[model samples]
Target chain A: MNRKISIRMSGLGGQGVVTAAHILGVATTLEGLVSTVNPFFGAEKRLAPAESYVRISSSQIDERGEVLYPNIIMIFHPHVITLGKCYTMPFFDGLQPEGILIINSEQPLDLSKEDLTKLGQLNARLFYLPATQIATQVAETELSTNIAMLGGLVGVTRLVSVEAIRESLAERFGGRKFLASATTAALDDVLKSKFAQVTQLVDRNMEVVHKASEAVQEYFIKKKEAGSLCMLR
Target chain B: MIEQKIVEPEYLFFQADREEVFITGSEALKEAIKRANVDMAISYPITPQSESMHLVGDLYVEGYVREYFRGENEFAVMSAVAGASMGGVRVFTATGGPGTLRAFEIFPAWAGARVPVVCAFMTRGVNSPLSIQPDTIEMAFMLHTGIVMFHAETAQDLYDMLLKAFVIAEKPDVHIPVGVFADGFFVTHTREKVKIDPAEIKLPPYNPYSSPVPVMDMENVPVRHMRDPFVMKSNFISYAAHASWQQEILAAAERARKHIHKYLGGLVETENEEAEILIIASGTAVSQSREAIALACQEGLNAGLVKIKSIRPFPEEEIRKLTQKAKAVIVPEFNRVGWLCKEIKSVVEDNTKVVGGPRVFGGMTMPPHLILAEIRRCSQ
Candidate 1:
């Protein structure tokens, strides 16, 4: 009955996953929602795997701690898929049937049939966006990929307004005007792009989200109908 | 002098009914912060002291406290509090033995600049064996480093001393970094009932010193008044700076002694006026010594105790007068034999035979009975 959403963002160091987590938290808080952002990072220099979390809810959060089983998982790097022993994978276990998973990568990934079978055991929905490619197309580099992935997240979850995300980005990167402008532009492109060829990648990512949400909704409707039938019988 | 309130003399007894609650020294610390009206606290998690940081984080989420900063490390935590204090906010921080050692470099910078940063230090024995138990080795070694240090004897003391530490540290004359030290195993992990009274505590406003802000001019431009060559040659300016430092130290010490005497009243005292044997101790050692003395008295041994409330500037005069009547003095400290007891022996001088009992084995609680035995042996 709670309208709470837990999101985990992870990537190799320097990809700005930590910053993206904070931006998401601040944006969600700005939209009259309660949010918490926590990061788990070591003293590793650039290129090491870094992970952060964000939790947003309509009401005050009782748990002021870690995200054990997150509702959404954002993988910002493509290669981490191969690093199968990453600590965040356990959070995907026993997820709610309607939970959403978003991954940000440069190319569409083909999970081995074996991996797909493992994922099918959990009833949650999964969506992956080639955020690096979209960022490179709009910003001329992958420097703004975190922001691009954030745009896709806002578009999908609608947990926080895109304008709130923009405001948070501007506030956090106020000193770095060039970076802020590039990120804003990238986010705007994701929001404005049509369902066409050059933007076909973004459209495909959206299609995955759309289909997953529909499947989740259908599963829940069947569950409720089954419950009513049982009560009548 | 403010007129002292006349209240009924009652024994300070711990309410046993509340002991069943699972609480740690870290929880006591957070309760102290809430009572002291601390506006913000920032810390990074580390062993033995992480619970204090977690407690503050919990309170902030509960809306009982405001603005808790989760920093990257001990360095960030200390610097962030320094910055927050400069911005006129009452800020606090907590760290354990290793974390405190890591933060050691920032102490003089904060003290010399006179930032009233309040921190709770859980004194764990350092190096080699690497035990995280309560010991005063760190506190004894670092006491003279321009920060005011208060040792908490009990869980209640941790709560009370911390509340007092912020008030005393933020005073105009004593605007130096202050720490409330508790033994890591004995106090850091120990749980007891701590009285929390928000209404009785009054947090003073932040008042920065009148000196101009320090800035490094890499361009070699003349910033403020430059040192005059003539004055430097005459040694007048050099002498004046040295004298100024001496006077500042004396003034700060006098102010703390006077404030403790005036505010704390009977709680700060020298006992058994005619007794020829004086034992000086601080923090939990005082409680241990008191228990020892009580047992010694039962066994018909005559010895007195002097519990030091403030360790910085060493309270030399008060200690000297207290030990003047004694033919022999014993100092029991929870540190290596060479530090605080040696300092006390040096102060009390040759006339009084001084006996030093340092906790050679780290983290061992010297029982009162053992202390009584030590007193009997020393007297014989």
Candidate 2:
């Protein structure tokens, strides 16, 4: 019955993972929800690994510690999968049965059915997006992939309003000349695109966040019926 | 002077009668600032000194105090406070060890211009094998920068010292900045009881010399220009300007010394009626020496302690007169062999003997008992 969404964004430094988390924090606050975003980095010089977290809740947050569990995990770099091994596993263990995992990979690798049974042991949903490809197509740089992932995040969680997310992106990146327009276009393009197997991307991503709010309402109903107890696996 | 009511809250007591309640030096600072009605505090979180900032941030958000939380780095935080102080507002910032080292450049700019900026410096060791512990090396290093430095020992002293720093630094004569230095792990994190009575403590009137009002005349403006170094040339004008800057520094130091004496009445007192040996100490060392002096008295050593309350002027005259009759003068500081001890030896003349006590390791508390032991050895 608790409607709390914890988001962890992981990637190499300078990929805007921290920036993405902050934007999400501002967007969630704009929705009148209680939210907090704390960035964690070790030797955060450019090209080094960095991770940040965003926690949003309909009620007050009493636990002021690192997010041990997360409802949504957004991975920005494909190579981070190896670097983030120890860090990622704990967050995966924290996911709820109906929680969603979104990874940014150039080539989608299906979980072996046996491994899938073990991975889906928690009954959580999983999806992968070639956001780097989308970023190259739109921004002509891998940097905008974070923007593409932000769009894909909206597609999966629907926890934030799409309009609010757009405003947050503009506020964060709106001042840069070429980067701004390209990032905005990238976010817009991803939200509107349809994938043959990625029906959730088209249907859930483009509902203009206010309408997206209804999808969250439906997802919670299914979640409650399944009785997804809020416990770290 | 402004008169405000000081509510004697149940928690603000020197000794807590109740077993359930207690507070740390860091928590005491937070409580004192809240009690003092501070408007804004900006600081980046660093170990041995982060609690004060964290408490202020939490209080600001909870509406217990009004403040602006800014920046995740110390450089941005100190710069923000410097800008805020220039706008004629009461502001405070804190850091320790390397954090203080990072902000060293801005210190002279703030002090030379005589900004009544108050900062709490938690002393930590420098470089290489970095530590988040306590020490006095940082304070000793910053001694010559002309900032009024106060060394505090107990939780009560920390509270009183912070309150006194604002009053002393704000006076026009002593408008040169102020810093309250406490040992990092020893005092910054240690818990103790502090009696907070704002009424008992009176803050001096705000007589700022450089407040927004432009007091200098434009018609009599002095102009000095520098030739480009690339040109490799100089003239009478450049030489005169350089000379004038040096003169101004001397004049500022004079004015700062006079003002500090006037503002710090009993706080920086002198007692030389009858004593053979004079001991010079400040901050936690003063408290340690006080205990050592008591032990020296028991051992029948004719010693008197003259704790340096205001360290900017160095209180040269009082220190010289007090030590005139002493057989030997001993100075025990937390810093390694440099700065303060050297300055004391430079100022005190005709002393038959002068001994610099052993250096206590940085980031760790040197027990008063150990200081007493050192005084006994020096007396022998």
Candidate 3:
């Protein structure tokens, strides 16, 4: 089996969506898996709707650009849903069957009945975490919110090993400068200043990942006999 | 520059050891230039192409490049690149879309002068309303510019084509500018695993003395001549001289076939050519076609693929032959004009068999599903 996994990360700009995709891609590559990462094409403006896509496979990956049929979708901010700050309308459009969706929120946002019914039909798995809260409480920086979101993804799907994530984090922050964009490089400077050294930055971000992984909670959406909406923990 | 052993082009391209690294197309270009032993690189900032030259500038800081600087604009930069190349040194530069049009006049001039300049065109849309997105419509204009053009399908192609372009363009029998174009953003911004050679070995330095045209180094030839510029004269001699020179440029590109084959394998690469349905494309569209072909195969539609690597010396005979037995031919493109489709249609015998598109322009990605839809429709 090819076992290819496609992930789409949607978030507001300055949320490290591109950086998170880069780290995940490197981790998958380190595990001897093939992966390709691409940021959404748009002007690099803060707070704008931003997205990044990653495709990981045990075999070679030929497809490129945005992941139109993503098996995994990561939402990094509540605004992506509540404020429609997403390129993909409904935020979960084109998600694969039995797909995993990890949203960065302490509680489930009020999803529409139509959207919920569609997700239920697809048998989608929904996971939520207070990712920004974990970043601030554990990593001591909101900039680490993207790392926290990755932790939630690992908690939900274990797509990559924690050790690989650690090494990838080191490679991104401790190794050479990785430029996702000019704004990203500037944000990295602000992040690096929060820690005493590169090692400290990696260690603190790892803590954010671990806490977010454990903090993540699944909200089960089941289609009742009457087609009524009910969420079960 | 860091000390690197000068190795034969064949040895470096084929026998040299390589390692796989996940990097963006821009980074891959930097890696290629590090081992190209280039003498100088001029840069002017433009979206998609800016990062590539920015990374190349980093090479200069790291001592991998001998000389690097920013130019006033695309035209000035291209002119500087030509001047540097005419001075008997390997030179590199990059521009795209608007920048490509901005520096348009210099491209043909480079070929007419036979400077052996290697330029990377990170192709994008050039419309009235500005767009910094991937589109190859600019390539249609460049086709008649008398320069050899190669379209890269991925970052790996960008790297390999760039390195090999230098050798191809500098051939004594076919000295001319070679444009290595990659779809902006699709290849430039996308990150994927690329195999690259070690940094300790580099291609041998260019020997300008072997150039078909006079090197402007002033070493053995007079520094200034042209007392009566040819363009100033409108007699038959001047007209004939210009006409023959243009023909020579065209001949130079034709002469490059054997060299391109020796390095790039062929102008076009075919897969399952015996199949009745064919998808012919270049650049990132070829990448999309691979996915669509795989999908089509799952549906039991046996479709073949023809990847056109060299656009200038187009695989005319190859395309015509490949499409001869096919019932349907599909050409997916990222540009609005469907220039590639027009080219294939012109060469293929059964013109109606060629489908102009399923094209997505203005930076929209061609969902493999769209191409798959075409395959399914073509089968019906």
Candidate 4:
């Protein structure tokens, strides 16, 4: 909701971390906001650590390269923290006060007492979702976990509208650029694939996104209801 | 009175039929080439500079480009491109860093022959130990290449400059090669909003008849008596002939200045005019300087920026005029050699006031904070 919001997303190579950042950028732009998605430099290989920075703003953005101070962080894979697979030391380093941290895990993070204390000192908000599980169940592909995480991001941050993201998905898969008839045909082609067409894929992904987003809202609401002494589970 | 040669670019930002799109610098250059109705694009792939050519290849497939191919190497690519340009078609080719050096020998000849070709040089560190990262040391060698140069600050600038490059290079008075330069990865990979003219209304094709010297062809004209070079006995004539040709190349580049100002608005772009501390930079370094100046202004530091968009003409007049009243000129560059700084000091008076080398090379970033520190130091 600020003029600018910087998010750092970390995961292994080939996990679609860059694509997620790109989708976020496209969504932000469609929402009449500006955004830049920067993938890590150098040649990235499968299983190697990869990270991307996405900066969305209502005004112009001139900053280039990595995001040093992020208002939000998305852990596309738990290994980014456990295996120390990131350019930034400690992975969560330089997280701003009251920052939002979203982890793609089925349960709470295995952070040490010191790390937890640091997060508490910063008053950071934390959330987790079984992204891979959700992707596998809905899209029948773990690769779609990034999409689920994006859904989770929108649900939690409410920074961009869901309508904008749907339009982004249509623009991306519909091959709709430059022509109106092509947009309709492309949407039909995508939705009519063996997975059905592009529209079917987009609609299915949107469903997963909606569910993941709702789950985050419900989980956080329940946590607050249980008070400050709530269990990690 | 100031000459009335240049006009503000605001009027042409998004012309009536134009569209605004978000794309990488590489893609922006490709769009410019497409709109310019380029005849040929011969290239060999290298990091950071590769995508521009790939998009050109797409244009070829889309029937917008007449000819496109990948050469065996940069040398072959430039040779093919020069050959095509001399054959009287508007041609383009791109190389970066080591690739630039691999093809460096052909550049001067491209200008000398007055081919009016355009080449994109995406700045990268030449290989010592094999660095594919962004660096501007490659620019140091190009300053003497007899080619006109345009160093872009952002994706939009890259788009605008590449389009202008074709028009500038093909001018009858300016039949010289133009090198459109942008930093590797930094600008090439950074996606930003760019406004471009629609395809239908782009610049017209290169007219070979417009060239001062004719395109290479031997058939039509009757063979006449051999020129005086055959009877020349002294090395003096040879040297004089070569010397005058070199002077002609320089003259051509000089002629390009008016066109550059007309097309690019001016060779040097300034921001925050009254600041005492002046930051002189080009390409991606200019982007960092903009941020640094903003930060300095927030803290009440009197600072401004003079970004060199045209590196070949050197913007000497503008730099001289701008730095006349400034207390100190700080030059931030991405290359360790600080070629831009050296050029600035070479032109501007009070060399002691000009400080260069708050630099980062080998793909490392030159953050605004680093430049801010230099501004703070100079303010004292």
C-alpha lDDT (0 to 100) for residue A146 of candidate 1 = 74
Number of the top-ranking candidate, with DockQ as the measure: 3
Give all TM-scores, in the order shown.
0.53, 0.53, 0.97, 0.90
Candidate 4 lDDT by residue in tens digits, B237-318: 7878888989999998998888887878889888886688999999888888887887887888989888899999778889
Task: State the lDDT at B241 in candidate 2.
Answer: 67
Q: Give the alpha carbon lDDT tens digit for every residue of B1-380 in model 1.
A: 11222211111112112222223467677766655556788988765677677777766775545688788878778888878776666788888677777777777666665667889887766756666555677775576667777777666678767867776777776667788887664555443334554323334434444212332323333455676643346487778875686567546645676655544442335666457777787776776677567667778888888877667746777777777768777777777744667767767757347777735445555655556667888778
Off by over 4 Å in 1: A1-233, B1-23, B198-250, B266-268, B271-273
Tens digit per residue, CA lDDT, model 3, B1-380:
69999999998889988899999999999999999999999999999899999899899999989999999999999999999998999999999999999999998999999989999999999997999888899998999999999999999999999999999999999999999999988899988999999989899899999998788876877744667767758899899989998999999999999999999999999999998889999999998999989988888888899999999898888888889999999999998889999999999998999998989988888999999999999999
Q: Every model's DockQ, to 2 decimals?
A: 0.01, 0.01, 0.76, 0.31
**Residue B89 shift from truth in candidate 4, angstroms:** 0.7
- What are the per-residue Cα lDDT tens digits for candidate 2 across B19-138? 221244676666556554455688787766776777766657756445667566777777887777765666787888888888787776676656677888877777568655555677
Pairs in clash, predicted candidate 2: A162-A209, B24-B191, B134-B363, B135-B363, B151-B283, B276-B326
Q: Model 1 over residues A1-233: C-alpha lDDT tens digits?
A: 25667777777766777668767777776776766564552332357776766768776442222355567777788766766524456435635545666667433455554444445555445566667766666554455667667866764666877567656665555422111113334544543353334344334433333332222211111232222111111
Q: Mark the regions of model 2 whose C-alpha exceeds 4 Å error after superposition.
A: A1-233, B1-22, B35-37, B62-65, B198-263, B266-273
Best candidate, lDDT-wise? 3
Instruction: State residue B71's C-alpha deviation in candidate 4, in Å.
Output: 0.6
Give the candidate number with the greatest TM-score: 3
lDDT of 3 at B146: 93
Each prediction's Cα lDDT score? Answer: 0.61, 0.60, 0.91, 0.80
TM-score quality measure for candidate 2 = 0.53
